[model samples]
Target: MKRNPMDFMPAYFTVAFVWFTTHFGGGFASGRQLVEFFVQYGWYALFTPVIAIAINALVFYYAWDFSVAHQKFQYRSWTDAFYKPYERVFSNLYDVVFNLVLVVATAVAFATGGATLADVLGTPYLLNTLVIAIIMFILTIYGANIVRAAASWIAVIVITGLLFIYGSNLVVTLPNLMTVLNEAPAPRGFWYALWQSIKYAGLQAALLGGYVAVTDVLKNKQDVKRAAICGFILNAGIMVLASAVVLSYYPTIISEAVPVVFIIRNGFGGVALELLVSLLIFLGVISTGVNLIYGGSKRIVSVWAKPEEGEKSIKNKRIIASGIYVFITWSIALMGLIPLVAIGYSYVAYLALPIVVIPVLYKGITKRGGEKGKSNELDAMTAADGPKA
Candidate 1:
């Protein structure tokens, strides 16, 4: 099939954006994650949105650029593209950690989603896992395009509703907003706030990198770059708005598992609020599930596809691999390991920082030495590794 370059960028960007937003799952939707990381810091949470946006932007920018560059050279995956440039003991360590992290993340998603579904619907968690696992398997077996189409429209609706709810509260509660802010407890020190911001940003960036991997399908570098920029802006704006809404209802939000729902119920009341919250949470869970299945399945399949070696007939292999992955994920979920894994993986994500930072750092150092550095170092590395496929 002849590829259409024009559709590539938008499609890729859309997929990437869906992946990014959905990465944090129920955490992002409920604001509990933010509360855990930022709100506890009180007024220090104000700087979090800014630091997170900047870090995410930088991470996405580098990942997107590297993906496009390496894809043009026929690289099949980020690991294929980056592993060589960063070849070392630590690079191998990163590969092991990265792959393990991906597996653990998908497992956690399945577990948590199952738990949430069971809790909300009053079904057994195992039943929920069975159902979600089947659905995820079907969606992932098809590929990224199907995943993108299924999620894109639903994501738009959820994001729009969230924005409306948050925006309305910002306006209606504006008169008392300052009072709420003043009453909020402050952080212990500037250093604490700084560390909190870095932690939040680093965690978010690691999650965002998985999203950027899907951008390899994008034909237009400009579209990928533009989409990332716009996506970061949208994310930052929403985070800020959410933080404000959260702080407005501060101290009270401390006890809420789902703070966004709390804000909606308190701000709007009645059927409108209920319906919006329901839709928001549903879409949030569904989009996130789809992305996890897609990314996890793709990674599993790619390991065996061996594009460089001209392997074929891997479709059956991919399906089987994906099924096993879903099975393991569902099993762990049924065992109620999701929350523990999610919390553990948050730190494991820090393990990815060195992997991501090294390439960008190398790029910077090479840039300083002009063409000589590139010719001696990067080109040599590329020549030694050869083209990916």
Candidate 2:
């Protein structure tokens, strides 16, 4: 009755897809984040995705290695590793910053969903936000199990739909693409663009660390490395493709509330296809919101409850925490999507660089190039039931 090891392949891809979706979310899906961070840079944007991919790979590997080495799977453990005697102080700071950013990110997702609903179905913005928030709560109330069940499949479908939609846009724009490329403006310039890309990657790096912590139970270095590689390739490939599509229609679509949706609605030129793509993106936003709230609430529970705590008690704590997060995010979502992505995410990106990304890079650079005691420790931890709380 033992599960086949080969079965882990699908699970591994599922985790990979979840990792991709966690970062993609509403902002990326709508083309707002890409326009701000990448498309605005003109031809220089091409280089940014490569850099983001490298940083993503390093951050992911660091997260996985840290998780397996200490048998701890949350941000608190990273604090312990990096801050030493001041673990509590640093960890609490990380916890606060992370949760605050997560709240804002969830709100951004809600806002994106609301915008999509309004554009596609003419729904009121407030009503759309409320409906999305309620649905997110329903999914998150069940914790990571529900998120895990929904996220990967949602990611696959949405990403595939995006490819088709964006690819079609690219084809339509191909004849004028050269003219468009020549006229593109680099308002931020190359150096600023490079820095923005790095900062943006750092923002996602912090979340990726915590996500890898909560969702993946790392069995070995190979598992960690495999997931890291898969995550990086998927993240980079999708972002690059999405950015290319945005670049093809830049400046014109930049001011729109939901750029990608707008591009699809107008450019794709079919009512049914446009609606299907819009619905898929709206679902993607919801899925990302669910994953964010679930991950953040689970981390809060892990920090508050001891690893020895009973499952029922832990589950109750997660539901309560997720409920509070959902309420706050729903309120903040009314502030709108542009401000959320423009101001909130940009600030968090800078904060995350030094705190989360650098520490991970430092660890990777300094750790002895050998597994040594890592395997034995992981074995012992798994024997002890594996990071319970």
Best by TM-score: 2
Weakest 10 consecutive residues, lDDT, candidate 2?
378-387
Count of clashing pairs, candidate 2: 0
- Output the number of the lDDT-best candidate: 2
Cα-lDDT of candidate 1: 0.58
lDDT of each: 0.58, 0.71
lDDT of 2 by residue, 46-107 (tens): 56977877797887777666666665545555456555555677677677668767877888
Stretches of candidate 1 off by over 4 Å are 1-9, 12-16, 72-77, 83-85, 88-91, 100-108, 111-126, 172-176, 306-312, 334-342, 358-389
lDDT of 1 by residue, 283-310 (tens): 5655666665555555555555544432
Instruction: Estimate the TM-score of every prediction.
Output: 0.79, 0.88
**Lowest lDDT block of 10, candidate 1:** 378-387
Q: Which residue pairs in candidate 1 have backbone atoms (N, alpha carbon, C) closer than 3 angstroms, thus clashing? A: none
Off by over 4 Å in 2: 1-9, 306-309, 368-389
